[model samples]
Target: MGALEPNAALERLYRETGWTMRQLAQEINRVGTERGTPLKYQQPSVTQWLNGQLPKESARPVILEAFARRLLRPITHSEAGFPAPRRGSTPQPPTLDGLVDLGRQDMDPSRRGVLGVGLFSVALTIPGWPDAVGRMDAMRTDPKRRVGQAEIQSVKDMTDRLSDLDDDFGGRYARPMAAAFLVNTVAPYLKATASSETRKSMISAASLLCYLTGWMAVDEGAHGRAQEYYVKSLELAGASGDRMTYCHVLRGMSVQAANLGHGAPAVRLANAAAEASPDSGARMRAFMAGQQAHAYALAGEKTNALNSLREAERAVNQAESQGRRFGGFSSATLAYATAEVRHALGDPKGSVESLHDHFRLRDSTDRQRSKLIFSSLLAERQLQIGHLEAACTTWNTILDEYPAIHSGRIDGQVRRIPSLLSPYRSNPLARQIYERSRELSAK
Candidate 1:
């Protein structure tokens, strides 16, 4: 009839088990999130629990489990003053409740729970290490929204427009807008009534949007949030049976992971993307292989990197042989990636040559941001190998390109110029360039 002295129980448990309040809170939050029941518990929350406050409804079972594991004994709800989700304890929420909660939590700026969580193994829960590769059983769900092609097409159009914004401007400018759209608009549609076919199509479109949003998070340097978006995108892809987008999101995740110096998991995600590429067209196949090469190179796997690069080249040639011109994965993209791959593998000369090839064989579709990215890579490689004057020349081009381009990644690239030229500050040419770069960055 009365709440037990949970303070005594929790204190004894922590004292005997050597669990700090912070550790207990972190474990509770971790397990809660893993089960789609996110809690904003902190170190103090455990102290509150020890002072006789029951944990949040979603976090109770996790607290019980954490204590149980430490005690090597099962902890009852009555003992912990926090019962598990059970029959009659509370009515089960809607099927979409967890997703809604995630969206809500993501929208809440105060919830900093997942912001610190970094890259995790992509193969953790995937059976046979395959879902990361896009191999998934079609998710079967009864439809509620009468989502038709119109809804799906609207989502696609918005995606394309937002993507253009991301390409032209910076993710810093677009990420919040996209997040608001997802939480305020798309989340509602996902729960509305629809036919089976329409639901799949809508989910497919939503998956791409999620991937795009994830990419924006990457551009904004929020790797943990990007990973969350990628995971959700993959889940939506599976529900829609859209293997191609699944592979693409996996590739996206791999790219950012590599950028963060997470080589092993990056390599695994890239290989899974490659395995998922069999059903893709030649251009996409080549793109996947190229990604694998980059991942391999980052992991310091020279032989594998070179082999994957060759495979990419073969796929590209096969596509060109059949008169298929690059759309998504163009020759310029491959050339620049190859350049990076070479640089990563310690081939500075080859990297420079590949950049040369990229420019020489450039396509009309090469956007302004693409040029700046590749040129930055060229300058970076040259600078890395002590070609000070050559790097300066490349910077002149980047400086000229800087005014016309407005992208976060481009801004980051331009800011690197001063640091790159810092060692040569006494040299008039380097000083002039550094001063000019700093001036431009200030504007």
Candidate 2:
């Protein structure tokens, strides 16, 4: 073979990023770690790639993602000097059929491990509300089966029950069951014959369930998988002319991005959600603004972040005066959002205070999963502020309920408890927490 040619396309993009080869490699490694795969690529690896070396197939996505996050835009194979993927380019399936396929994969035991490793991409292409609205083609109805209002209500009721289960236990225990329901029940309903109004209502109901499934996936840390479900939810919501659900899914996507530390994408998605619903009710407005505030804080836009927080607070107060409640968005939720914003803005003390307010505001109806998560956050911040004993006390409360929950995110928090208290292991409380963490982790 002739000598390899220089990759001019990659070289140009590399220059645009203004990153040293080592920095580029480090970013790639970081992305790998986020995807549950630790990589040790060094400057030499990046040097080879710029000099015409092809990255391993698995590394290609990681490399593209690193550049995408830095450039704040999608980076395609051609744009990055990489060849098209060798896999066959199949046409996209119809909406309902695609949902079935996605749900089946999610439910299958063998494919789940593979799904967990799918990388969350900051450069994912999100369809605008106008573009997605009425985008689905006419479905080939299953004339043998018909659905109506009663069926639609059943779907909604089932989704609510599954959501409750997910809250009381955790996504690890609830997601597969949700996926199974989506595949076995919801998919068939989408294809069943019905009047246009009934069909649209059913689609709207299905979209909400899809969103719930995606939220569960996020709790499990299957972020890329969650994005897939979120996109499908958006499409279904749009096809049904359910604008609110579409915006809700977008905000969930933003939450996933924020959790993954992809601040730019998070902010972009949060803004998109708010823009999509101009005349949203006060309660709905608060829901969107709180997430937007979290996103802006993560993006390091202090002014925009503070502005959104104030808007959320005002909206919440307005909503209360009007006696309107929108799902789980309330003062407690705002306090949690405030804590996230403060934490991101380097105000650990303020964040801790907000968290205290959150717990004080929370009632029995709050999701157990969230209680554990926020409590974990409170403990960590307490530890950060030189309140070791207080942190241990908070952690003890978490441990009392930790083994009962099975969320990947919460599991991660528990896994860290031992190390977090290791430095102060000589202290009785710290040692007790550390020992208990090891004991639970072993199980």
Candidate 3:
């Protein structure tokens, strides 16, 4: 059969009823389950419907039932623009046009609930379209400009707040907040008429915002977008002559690479960070070294990992000797980075030690959240080394604090706990921890 015509009847019903793709899918799934004809539909399937694709024989009845529920009016197969059932056909992936159509229908200003649902549903599945890297490279070749003290201070304040938000709530909320700041605060200043000095500072600030946005994208599993943002940020940092910001961006790139199993590239990026900021304060040196150690560990270079870890320790010590007045790094941040390296190197005891140090230095507001993450990490490491009871105990602690911490990072850590405890799933303690985590997530 030729491609089915756009289903104007279904489209009008969906629009008049103010139904989101997700809500429609959920209602379909619910009805199917109740009638003993269970159906499985992912977000992508809803996307297909919104695109006007005729549902296959198997999906048609359920879609009709779902729209009936949504519109509170009976819908028949003929009314939904379907012919008699025919079986056996391959399914196509949802298209961007389909998603956009659904978004337009659900984003109507007159429907409050539908609008909220549409925004979240669409945001969750938004594709990361890559930008041309050559543009950034061209900008980098442009003449460098000087930046002023006033703009520098403003950038500093914004960066500090962004960092605090990341640490507090992880990357979920941080991404949108950073994006707003970039569009509203940094981007305007970068394009504004200013002296050479002000322009340079504005560029520096904009580059940092780009880096932050990229880091947030990585956290949300949008690696392609993250890479694009990182490249752009690196180009901007080069033009601004901000070696410190360059180091931060490189460090971020290393983390992304390591997470994606590109260990060698991660190690190279970490080394570049250290080399670019050799004269930076002790804390900065330690942070770079800590990243290097983690990268080496991921690359299976045990000796290099150990050496880098020791170097990081030394850098932290030197930073402490500088009267605890390091400009960029704090004791707590250094300790957290050190703990991550130790955890990567299979040193559970050392990881816990460093984590304890981090706790001691962390501000009161961060204690509950950081502790939840550190505890989860500790539990995973324990399970790796066959410390079942210890792992269970740590996991229990994480579960207890999880309700108060809504960080995406912490949620990831929690999700990993079940697999780590798979061997002990039959054990009462392990099952208890797992059940509690499930319950917390349900809430």
Candidate 4:
């Protein structure tokens, strides 16, 4: 039989039940409550219904229940307009084999790049961000040796390389490198490793790498790829049973969602991260709170955003009280996070302040030149908020630093300056910066 058309069924049901869109939504929510499945039917749901789009997976069951209740009969999937389940077909295995291959390649020493230098710099500057040896110690002390020193080293090396790529080339080059490392170096170990320590190490490394990859992907404007990497990282963290890592990955996911303009999911992911691991270290908890605040700001929930920001501050204070030094968190990391939240909240002054703070923390070493690509991003944001002089200054500084770095990633970011400063292209400072960027691009 031809499948029942959802649009036709929806029209008929609405007419027969004398239910307007609002009434139908209320009924669905009521049915969901009665059936122990709380439905969140937002305006988008109504729009989708009007456009004949199917409800999402989470809402499907609740929607079916509402239909059954309204019709005074129990409805099977077919009756509710769902397609029949295919029979006698084995389920396909997950297509993570490519990722496994890439993870292995990431482990190869030849693949390490200048970005590794930035990662090492961050580790040196940030106290809590562990190196291979530190991560190894953490794993060895664990009752399970699921994570090995070799694995830890591999992960560290990959993360460092990714950071370098980000610093040198922008995310365009960093993403492919990160994805390769995750698939080749990490996936195979994940698939075959049995020890708890090994698993934990693998999970931590994979989560961190995936997070980095997702960030790069976001920078490159590949939203779907970024989301996938974040989800994969979250899954890896869960498998390793590391709540802290899970929380971190969740926060990363929230950032991606927020960037993609999915504010609701962003808020949910951030809140879940904050709630799930309240006992985590103050730094970690603060990170989650900060993420939540950013999400709220993006959602235009000004009051909630401010509340979460305050909560983040409180967490930071608690972390400081716990004698947590600011090693694992770099001035750049903190500044970037703060700037992002401030920008979301439409506080340009605050954003600029945070960016300045980040700039203050940057290292003078050649190793850090690649990671300095973030300076360009900060300048771009400054331009957006009408801080033309500040942006011009930052852009000049970035261009000066770019020639010393051999990273394709940094080059890409520098190349973007011309376009970003196009509106002010006629301004002397802006013109100078753009010309310099153009010179670099020409190379």
Give the runs in model 4 whose Cα sits over 4 Å from its true position. Answer: 1-98, 101-185, 191-208, 260-262, 328-336, 361-374, 381-387, 403-416, 419-426
Candidate that scores best on lDDT: 2
Error of 3 at 171 (Å): 1.1
Selected candidate, larger lDDT, 1 vs 3: 1
Model 3 residue 159 CA deviation in Å: 3.3
Give model 3's TM-score versus the native structure: 0.62
By TM-score, is 2 or 4 better? 2
Candidate 3 local lDDT, 1-443, one digit each (tens): 77756767677766776767777777878866765668877667766665677666666656765675565444444455555443222111111112112223322324423322311111112111122111222211111223357766887788878777766666555666676566445543453456665666777777787787677656555565566567667766765666677778878888777766677878878887777774666677778877888899888888998788788778878878867865445677767777776767667778777877876887655545556767777677677767788888878877776766546567778777666666677999988887777677666
TM-score for each of the candidates: 0.71, 0.78, 0.62, 0.58
Q: Who is ahead in lDDT, 1 or 4? A: 1
Per residue, candidate 2 scores C-alpha lDDT tens digits across 259-286 of 8888999999999999987567788889
Question: Which run of 10 residues does model 4 get worst, by summed lDDT?
Answer: 119-128
lDDT of 1 by residue, 1-443 (tens): 77646567567767877877788777777766765667777887777778887766755656765675566544445555444344333322221233333444455434433542554444433322244323222222223235567877888888888888877666656665676667566655664467767776777787788888878767766666677778777777776777888888878888987776777888988887777654767788788988888899989999999898888888888898898756777677788779878888889989999998999888766666677777888888888878888888888878976886656577788888898889899988789889999999999
Q: Which candidate comes out best when scored by TM-score?
A: 2
